[model samples]
Target: MADALLEFRGVNTYYGDLHVLKNVDYSIGRGEIVCLLGGNASGKSTTMKTIMGVVRPQSGQVLYDGQEIADLATSERVKRGIAPVLEARRLFPRMTVYENLEIGAYTRKKGPEFDQDLERVYQLFPRVKERRTQISGTLSGGEQQMVAIGRALMSRPKLICMDEPSMGLSPLFVEQVFDIIQEINKQGVTIFMVEQNASMALSIAHRAYVLQTGVVVLSGPAAEMKENEMIKQAYLGEMQVEAA
Candidate 1:
């Protein structure tokens, strides 16, 4: 894509003797909601880790806004506008909801912009505002997920990478979270998410990539992917069984 905001070219990552990502290539365009879908141990979380600099590729290019960033520190990447709402809603359990959101702005200098961004997060997640003084760990799973997303938005990111945003929530909360993701995308922040809920992800995504055993097996427009027989048999079929 000519306006690609993030691109991974020929990325190969390993953990000791176990190879996790193999020659993976993906391009997420500006203002797009791009999802990475896969089953367990398919290296989906590794992909998110590589993007966040938690894990480095042995060889290949990780470009953000056209600049190579495979070697940049996680803080540097965050400062450059790449924020991650990590898997399972990783939050400081002891901190209040508002305090956790404040930490997301660690890389930025405090000012009026901080207040504006905090308000923006509140506008997006009113429940979070309601629970601002509550300890994050005491909140329900769905409430914690909202705080996690709000924390990411506090950074004013141009791109937000979400890992399994629907991992552990009720069907209703999953729908609410997906709706918020769409709203976030509409407001112009590009999203690169790793999700097991293929149907929900594709329902909102502009494009998607399917990974299996560390390799990208399919990729294209979300509408086309939803209709792909291979996708139906492998991913959607499982979702159908669960729904039934």
Candidate 2:
């Protein structure tokens, strides 16, 4: 797409002798919320790894803002405005909330702008602001998730790639997390997320792609995907009727 902020062209990845992503091609437009949905071992997490340069693709290109970043180091990718909220809310257990967030800005110069971005993150997550001095490991699951997101935001990234943001959270926290994701997208940060909860992901996503066994089985606008019979049956746990 002409306005694509991120693009995967013919991406193929492998783990040892086993193949994972299979010639995948997808794009996320500027200011769009795009979700990749799949079941376990369906290559969702591998895709995120490829984009973040955690795992380099054996073939093809991963483009960010029209630049080929497939070979850039993970930290370099962060400097290029790509930040990841990894799965399981991986925060420093021994660090204060403030320290954890400060670590997110390591790629940037320490100055007034960094402080400004920290305040922006705090404003977005008031709960995190209130617990700045507390140990991250002592927070509730929902609060830890908030800190994870706030830390990612501290980088001031143009694109935020979240891996299972709602994973392991309570039902109420899941709802709140998705709400915050929508609010973040509205504020002009493009989001690309990998999620197992198809129903919830589709609800907030502008577009979605379904990965099945390392291949893309479906792709379209979120509303249309929600109504798709196959998606409803398999991912949403609903039965679809056929005309007799």
Candidate 3:
């Protein structure tokens, strides 16, 4: 995986005495969208935390752009071009959309490039720009998700880790959210997402890893996974009957 932008090699993480991630290994190449899929309590969110440095692995490596960063601080990771669109769109409720987005650039100094990135986010999320002066807490759920994604883009990150981007959204919004994710990947930002919606995730993913009880049970190209009998039965709610 010499061309990979992010690599998790033999990563084993624990929560207290609980072994959360066991020898997890995966990679996301530059300009690709990779999804981690699993059911409830399957360590999908823990994988995202490990990458973001919020939860440290007991052993192994997290390499970003060929450099090891498992020991780096969370803020240090952000400075090195990792941004997260956390679950549930954790925006500053009392703050205006404009102010919330500006806070995302706190790791970088104010300058022309930073402002240009803000404009870039606005262009990507026109609804955000329209609601820039509005209170973030007051926007619709879908609009708030857009602002959360816009905030992540404001950081000008090389990689964006999204945790359950479609969670808590209506069917229409879920479709729209997936569309936006594909658009963002087309714009050249690598995406590593943790999702429970396997069908939606695989539709836009270049590759995907299926985690079961903290271990990777399946990994392959998205198109292949879509037709996999095990995946269809387990995640996509499809029934397959064997011929007698």
Candidate 4:
């Protein structure tokens, strides 16, 4: 908390009449991988949206780099170097991979910086480079995911909040995606991710938080979480009951 890169305090958010996030408290240190683990509708997506300023919080504060960012809108937040790769992989259907990534650099279009950013994203996702002229709608699900992540990276964000990066990939693709996420983090971006696959999330995360019914139920280092009896039984695939 004393040296957190991002912090959310008493954050409460709502959609119409339904309150989605209730007094949420979270923090991520610089260049750390922190995963938000929860079941369906446990407010994981809301956390990302709230941080991105897509959904405004009525009674809370979000601070990034020690400055309050709750007042900033979505575009403004992105301009401040926060990028999000959402669950649905929102890519321009008719646009080429290059075009999609170009949109991500809307805020950073200053001479050679824009060119360098494109090169960086292409380096991170060579699949996108190979498909530069190809329309995004025709790509496979895994390729689409790569485009989404690459588009986000084109912004050169200080923090990248990924929501369900492995939602609908094959086992191999899922592993590949997780590996890419780790690689992205290694390049000095603070990561706050939400994933349904607790096994994989815990395995890759440095620290993790388990949320249920919009509340944090557990918090610990990933190694301890991986060995946790409850986690091992429920989300990490069923394990034999240890000698009742």
Highest TM-score scorer: 1
| Model 3 clashing residue pairs (backbone) | none
For model 1, state the Cα shift of residue 126 in Å.
0.7
Answer with 1 or 4, whichever has the higher lDDT.
1
TM-score of each predicted structure versus truth? 0.98, 0.95, 0.94, 0.93
Which is the winner by lDDT between candidate 3 and candidate 4? Answer: 3
Rank ordering of all candidates by lDDT, starting from the highest: 1, 2, 3, 4
Per-candidate Cα RMSD to the true structure, in Å, reads: 0.8, 3.5, 3.5, 3.2
Q: Kindly report which residue pairs in candidate 1 clash with one another.
A: none
Give the per-residue Cα lDDT of candidate 3 at 193.
96
Candidates sorted on TM-score, descending: 1, 2, 3, 4
Runs in model 2 deviating more than 4 A are 238-244
For each candidate in the order shown, give its overall lDDT on alpha carbons.
0.94, 0.90, 0.89, 0.86
Alpha carbon lDDT at 165, candidate 2? 94
| Candidate 1 wrongly placed segments (more than 4 Å) | none
**Top candidate (lDDT):** 1
Q: Give per-residue CA lDDT, model 1, range 1-244, as digits (tens).
A: 5399999999999999899999999999999999999889999999999999999999999999999998799999999999999887889999999999999999999899999999999998999999999999999999999999999998889999999999889999999999999999999999999988899999999999999999999999999999999999888999989878
**C-alpha RMSD between model 1 and the true structure:** 0.8
lDDT of 2: 0.90
- Please tell me which model should have the higher lDDT, number 1 or number 3: 1
Model 2 TM-score, all chains together: 0.95
